[model samples]
Target: MRLRLSALATRPWLVALLIGLAAQALFAFHLDRPGGIMFDEVHYVPAAKALIELSGPRNIEHPLLGKELIALGMDLLGDNPFGWRLVPSLAGTATVLGVFTFLMVLMRGRMRVAVTGAALAMLNQSLFVQARTAMLDIFLGAFLLWGLVFLLWAMRGTRGQVLWRWCVGAALLGLATAVKWAAAPYIALVALAFVAIRLRDARRAHRPLAAALLSGDQPHWPGLPSLAGLALLGAISISVYFATFTPTFFYLTGATDGLSGLLHLQREMYAAQVQVLPHHNYQSDWWSWPLILRPIWFFYAWDHGAQRGVLLIGNPVIMWGGLVAVLVAYAVSFRGRALRPLALALLWTFSVAIYAIIPKSLGFYYYYHLSAIFLCLVLPVTFDHFDRTRDRGWEEWYVALALVCFGYFYPILSAAPLDGPMAFAHWTWFPGWR
Candidate 1:
């Protein structure tokens, strides 16, 4: 048993994962001490409070799971700002772990890529900020990624493995949906992508592939048992989702009445979301996001005496670097040199970009669904190129560049109070950022 445990610990990806989790947890703990609602937390904390009281206004649009989770934190920690934000922080940390594990599975345990990806994700300001706040994005993002991770794991496993993964994926999807309805489209897209890929493979083999594909197999596929296993797993996952919610859904509100009530609530939420007439200073279109044209300022403060302050903004270097990396991945993949990585990057980037163009009524900068996933895709490509070239000097230069960029922007990302002039200096770089 000791030997087995030691062997597991020796895995570089696992070691890196442990370290990443620790770093995230520590950062979250430090940030948790700031005991006041910031930005959207103002909206969500009240919503969660209403949820706990059961007599407050109902948010029919979003599912209760995320709010309920926040309430649980508040219940244990006292309904302070820290209590409300704790769950999302924990979820965000867990997402780093999940991404590591998923990438480990995807790369078949490529230690360098896995470790780099997880590290980059943990350090990302967008993800880090979301994790430290009381919002649905982190919770939903974590679950959605978890579900996809399991699905990917199943795809690469044996019959038993596939079965286990499929069930986990389905259950996760249900939980994801419960957190935010936006995840539903991602889940559907994944399912559709899986089907399309399978069909393509079947056609390439020129065999009667529908039955085999539906069964999760090909004529000469190595893992024949996986077909039936995946089918069963998918079925089990869907069942788990319904099973968990149907009761709360029926009890909290009467079944028939609850269903109707839920629908009514949804309509109200939809109308509120679609109201485009209302104007706000921070409002921005989706196209500008890729260019880092506008960044939502989550928190800011001033201190005349201290002559210092904190401003929460996305790390421009990482954000802009990721954008370029995506483009590079596309260019490389267009040449058919490294198809898989490019395909993953393209799918995630494109999916999020398309959502931006949909003219949705209530889109926010936080609507960057591909946020974490984009980092995941970019890190691997960056590392892969560096590894193949074996250019230590260039790698050092890249690290130095990333560090300098992050360091320069650290004061802004952290909520450290700054004087008005200093704050204006940071704002001067990105005028539209404010």
Candidate 2:
């Protein structure tokens, strides 16, 4: 039994995952801190509380899965700050695990680089800030990150592996979408990427294009699904998404009209989302995201004679360095002509378009988390191909710089007691960040 436990402990990604989980717990779970209602907690926590009572949900603009998870945490831990914030904190840890394993896969078991990637992801202000709050985006972001990773694995897997991964990925994608419609772009991207991979594979075979796709590549793709089988995966996703709203089915809210209310509720939510709000202190244009400008202020308080604030900013090193790494990835992929790297570049480009076209009047720094997750994939994956000494030097600087940025910005991200309002404001190096 001891030997078995020791063997299990040595499995890949376990140490990295434990480190991430522990670190996230430290940052998030507070017995007596950030102890009152937070920015969006005002919306999500109460909805979750109402969910526990079988009362009507207060917010219908977003879906039920995230609130249900919050309710579950509240049930397990009671309705307090730690209780309400619990699931998101775990989701944040899961996201760190996702990033770790994702880089592990791409780098072919280079554990150190993968761990560094996870550290970068963990320290990023967007994840850190969202993890500590009861909010929708972290849940959405975590699901999408894992779902995207699973989709990539499914696409690359052989035989029964492909089928199982796709099935799991579909369900995860569904869960991601259920948390918020913001994940729709990722869902669509993964679906398109799946189809594209199959279509490309079909060209190598002499079979009919549709049949080749449905049948999957063999010898190379034994035991993979047919068209009907793929449809089943999609159905599983739809079912999971619908099932998350089971509570809604039992109790009608302003969003849900009745048994046939799902469609009406969806339309109403879409309408609400698209309407413009011209005035907000921190709203940003899409152009600013690449530069990490204009972080949205999510919360502020003057309690017990101390000032506090929560800002959705990205770590400068990760955001700015990752941007440079993206261009490098594009160059390396184009020059090396690597299939996966090329796909990563295309996905990043695609995300920029998706971000630009969103109809919301406000886009904020936090929305860039999706781009950041994808960019996280680029650095480690590219770093693996670099010469040994240079790779070491680069990663050393990357980790040190990212950690320094995290330290500099922690007061603002966590709402730690400040000397005054401007104490946190002083951390903003750029005029635009203010």
lDDT of candidate 1 over 1-434, digit per residue (tens): 22343466457655755756675665565564344677778778887776666644455456667887888888878788678877888887778777777767776765555655666666666777787788888888889888878877877767556555666787898788777767666666666666666666767877566554555454322254334544554565455444434323434433324657555655665675556766766666776666666667776644323333334455566667777777777777777677656766766676576666554665567777456456665656555764644634443345456667666766666555555654546554767865
Q: How many residue pairs clash in each candidate?
A: 10, 0
TM-score against truth, every candidate: 0.85, 0.90
What tens digits encode model 2's per-residue C-alpha lDDT throughout 396-432? 6778888888888887787778998567658767787
Best by lDDT: 2
Q: State in Å the error of residue 25, model 2.
A: 3.3
- How well does model 1 score by local distance difference test? 0.64
Per-candidate Cα lDDT values, in order, are 0.64, 0.74
Question: RMSD of each candidate?
Answer: 4.4, 3.8
Residue 432, model 1: Cα distance from true site in angstroms: 0.6
Q: Model 1, residue 159: what's the lDDT?
A: 56
